[model samples]
Target: MTLLLLLDDPAQPGVVELQSLTDDGLPEGSVSVAADDLASAVREREADRPRWVWDDTSRRYPPLLAAGVRVERCHDLRLCHAILRRSVYSQSSTLAGAPPGPWDGPREPPPVEGSLFDDVGPSVVADPLAELREQLAAVAGADEPGRLRLLLAAESTGALIAAEMQRDGMPWSVETHDALLVSLLGERPRSGRPPKLEALADEVRAALGQPSLNLDSQPDLLRGLRAAGCDVESTRTWEIKALEHPVRDPLLAYKKLSRLLSANGWAWMEAWVHDGRFRPDYVPGGVVTGRWATSGGGALQLPASIRAAVRADPGWKLVVADAAQLEPRVLAAMSGDTAMAAAGRKADLYQGVVDAGIVETRSEAKYAMLGAIYGATTGPSAVLMPRLTRAYPHAVALVEAGARAGERGDVVSTWLGRTSPRPDAAWQAEHAAASAEGAGADDVRAARRRGRDWGRFTRNFIVQGTAAEWALCWMASLRRRLLELDGRPHLVFFLHDEVMVHAPAEVADEVAVAMRSSAVEAGRLLFGATPVEFALNVAVVDSYDQAK
Candidate 1:
């Protein structure tokens, strides 16, 4: 009744049969052990049975026994079967020097066993219930929570979702709304001359208090108007006027135009909300810097039409707040540029840099300072680099150090654990070769490129990642407070710098308090009790634009 087993290496195609044992006489219980441990167990069993004789010539053996000579029914039947099967196969393969046959390789291991009895012996295991309970407790006790908020104008939810899906690499299509007011209006070409859509424009412009209303000069100006009241035609007119404004900068202008043409575009977006609640598609990992993405509707790119559509639920008011020059302020704090930090603390950092005699003009200061931090070498950076080096020597040096580190192929981490991936060896080698060439036209160009790339990486890794962390904390706090409040106001939207909550008209003040508290808590969590502050504007309206 001796049985033989064969085993093989899949990669090598080599087989081995290493041992033999009896079938019914094999170890008796259901317990199993790894094949490697079989030899030790057999030897241990033999130590207790010194008088028992084993025949080397025949491939058969007697039953195993412990030292007491009591027939040890303690034999693990499954373990013995597997071990013998593997050993026989391994030995057979070694003898054959070929791949194992169909019945050759090691058999799958037996299922694990456990017992209900607690005091059965040392073999009994403890239940995982206690461990699970501890895990639940830890989860409850952890103060930090991670979640995302997406604030989109009720009308732009579709575009936001589409954009978010695009960012997430998800395939999606935009829905066309033929009956939407924008489509109907846009389809009819304004008479031989463009209509005095300026009145509608004037109303919206006056509402937002923006001076630029020359439709020829400000195309897409309608995108800026808020939908304060529910006059649908007026809302459509405001959006169209904004969209029609001529953009002086071609690139910026194109973006404005594209936003209008995309299906579920700015115009159609005005109709997709349920009771004025626009739920934009939120792609959590949309931005490379951990910012959220909106899909179908340009949720992130709030058009005037959509903004006008954001209305406070009856009895509630919309409270809007935004970080002033958030990135620059963050950069100042992170780089420990005391001067820069002080400037940010007082007024706009860019303007402060200009006043400090860093550059001759505001534009120069902005470009050079931003370029210095962001590794901008072309266009704006090219014009501003020298000014930045002269004005803020220490700030320039800090970013330069980061750039140097990046050029050497080091991965940089933010103040938090978030890290940037290391540059490939190819990039490093190219940079080194460029550096070795020494200041020729090509060499200078290469050097600038390398420096700029590195600076850009370092700049964003710190500012953007930290900003994302701050945002996550803020959202978490707001969520918690919302849960605590009695009136169940729903969080309808979250944009990078803003949040929109839909609440009853009566609880508008309460919601505003909650929003402000969340921002303050977020600031404290990230920067400690610093003097960082935010300004908010609140309004009640039937449309998004009216709230502003």
Candidate 2:
């Protein structure tokens, strides 16, 4: 059964309308419930295990979670609509050709005082039922309906997981965090930079022979560096590291400390951590390639120096797991490259490449494989590309094909049906001007450079996008498995290709098994019966830093 959940009416400020439907989305029955009774109504209906279809999971699920109610499955209409409205496979569907509507904007947060539909107007009245039917038609008429269906399901499941993870929050230790900060930064100051950071800035200024140089200002620092006999164009670490000068060490130290202090310093702990948990606002499908993005907290960019603060609660453990060589394994599976799959069979893919005599060392293999997916044109990656191509032609060919398609201003789809957006009008205009009669050499050069840059984006897009799909499937499977366990073993944090589950110590070992098996299931879901192995390094630890 499919339950279409929506606001009751614009006049009814705090009522909800629930319409029951068959699997094909045909209406069967309906009910209206007040906002105050929503949790009980939902809980009652959940006994049937119906897949709840709502406008946005973030807006609908969070309230129920707060009431201590959880659902087994849901279909997030907003997320599904986004997928169907742009997917190449659904080009002929009406939803794809329709003009932008209310479904296109950012999701609304759950109302704190009134009904979600109270502000609905004639122009903005987006009926969830109408959108649901259109999405169903689009997926039904898609070229690869099976793949599209899987992508939508995985994407919607991701939305639910994001909300649940936010509700549960990652276990955090504020005391450990403050101690680590003090140890590295020499005490949090009342109104300025910490002592160690200030001292490093002073050292940099003295070495550069500028007593009043503003270390915080890049332009001023770059001018000071140049005046001190250093020919550098930028303050990037790579550029500064190559120059030999007294200012080098001090400037690098200052920059590193500055980042640590600014990114996840004492101020961050006070704002994000609450009680014993760190809750980050996760934005699903936030990246164009389908990777998640944090709206405020630096969840994705958790620094290694302070990971020790991610301590498990009493009698609980953090089961951390991350896939090795994720992109390459994804490339192998999606392309159906049996040879590449064989290389990674029961072993590290990079090491497998070395054993296969493709490259002399593991580092070279790493560079070459990453170079292929990321479209590297120079340096060690370019040097090692030929050998890698010769060894794994099928895998190389897949990314190369995507690059060619992007250069032609065409869209490319991932293993599932998430398509890369077409180049904008400005990009088209640039290409047109370069191709005009008697075009300048400079114009042609600029056009070629821009084309290569976009090509690189599309080349990585296919692999990265598919890898993200795999991750969604992995988490979805693991989510179900964790619910089957005896204790409260729930996912609390997730970075791309890595996840941390907070579970009882007695169930930590079970969590490890679930993590491994779910990885296999994710692979099978994405690529059925493939030889590729999506191996994970599962570690049961007391703190995030303890994991490899």
Candidate 3:
């Protein structure tokens, strides 16, 4: 069963229009519900458990979630439209071939409810019925509609989760965060400069022998460091780490404190965390590789140093589950390499590779395998590459093919259906200019460099993109399982390969089992009968920091 709810405004009445969509994308009939009566209408239909279809899950679902209504399933048009438009599977479909118009850009969901874009009109976006028809046609005509459908469903579920997670909010301890900031950066200063940070800055200045040097300015700091006899090109963290100087430790300390203050210090806590929750706006399918990105509050890059601040409620526990070596396991399954799959069965993938006798040490195995997927053609990774190739030929060949395709400027598709973006017109012009008659050596070298860089991107794209799909399926399945378990355990935080669920202490064991089961289910859904095992290290702890 499916219901399509079109929202109007929140203050006045509830939803204005509702329809039941058939399998063929036609609305069997429309349901008329007054503004204030929408929740009851949804509640009445909840018995049927219809999968809701809406323009944007983020837009339409928040109102329902606010009204204490949670749907079992939904199809988010904003997310699906984005996926189908970029997918190679639907290249020949009507939606794919349609005029290059409105659908190119997504219908933006309101940042906060009832601010702007409350107008419901014909041109708001493509008509819901018409858009649905095109989407279904696109799916029906896809090369593998089943897989594309799975991808669409999983992607939509992710959108719903993003909204719900934001609304429900992640359990955060503002007090704990403030205390950690104080411990590391000293108390918030009257002049707004962290005291500890100022102390470190003084130390840096004394070490560099520049009494009046402005450490805040990159150019000034660089000059001062050079004057102190540390010859370095830039003040970048990686470059600074390699240089040994009297000011090195203090400089590093200053950087760490500066990042903490600028990125996630006292101001961040006051603005983002409220009522013991850190509710960042999450953008689903935000990354090119289909990873989620936070719009504000830097949720995706939550510092490990502040992990202690992410605490559960007094009686609840945070069940943290991170997929161990997710990408390598995905590669093993995609490449159909039994040897690699066998290696993946062990806890540490690099150690597993060492046990297989492919590399001399765990470090060698890690570097070599990463190099193969990421196109690292030189350095120690290249030196150890031959042994990895001999040990896992299939997996090695798979990424190599992707890289070759990229070098030729061909687009690559992930396991499910997300296609890589084509190179821009500038890239083509540069390559053409390089290959033209009497091209300069610099031009040829530049073109070759760009081509190789693009090759590396595509090489990682296939593996990273596929790994993202696996994660989507994992979360989607886990959400359903968590829903079944009395709604006590709810997904609260999600990083790329990790998820945190806030659950009651008594249900911790059940949540752990569900976490492992969801991993297997996700693998089965994506790779069906493959030998690869996606293992997760699950821990039920009071604070999220304790999990790792």
- TM-score quality measure for candidate 3: 0.95
Judging by lDDT against the true structure, name the best candidate. Answer: 2
lDDT tens readout by residue for model 3, 315-355: 78899999998988899999998899999989898899999
Candidate 1 matches the true fold with a TM-score of 0.50
When summed lDDT is taken over every stretch of 10 residues in candidate 3, the lowest stretch is 114-123
Top-TM-score candidate index: 2
CA lDDT of each prediction against the hidden true structure: 0.44, 0.89, 0.85
Per-candidate TM-score against the hidden true structure: 0.50, 0.97, 0.95
Answer with 1 or 2, whichever has the higher lDDT: 2
Q: Write the per-residue lDDT of candidate 1 for residues 1-548, one digit (tens) a residue.
A: 32222121122222212233333223222223333333344455444432111111001111111111111112221212211222212223221233433223222221122211111222111321222222223222322211111111111122222222222221111222222324323442333211223334444455545556443333344344323232223333334344433322322333344344443443354444433345444544355455666544555776554354455544655555455566666565556666766656544666767677666677776777667657776897777787666655666776677776765666554433344556666676666777674546786577567656775786566566666666655665675586667676645566676666656667767877887788777777666655444333444344455555
* Order of models, best TM-score first: 2, 3, 1
Runs in model 3 with CA error above 4 Å? 3-15, 106-123
Candidate 1 local lDDT, residue 295: 47
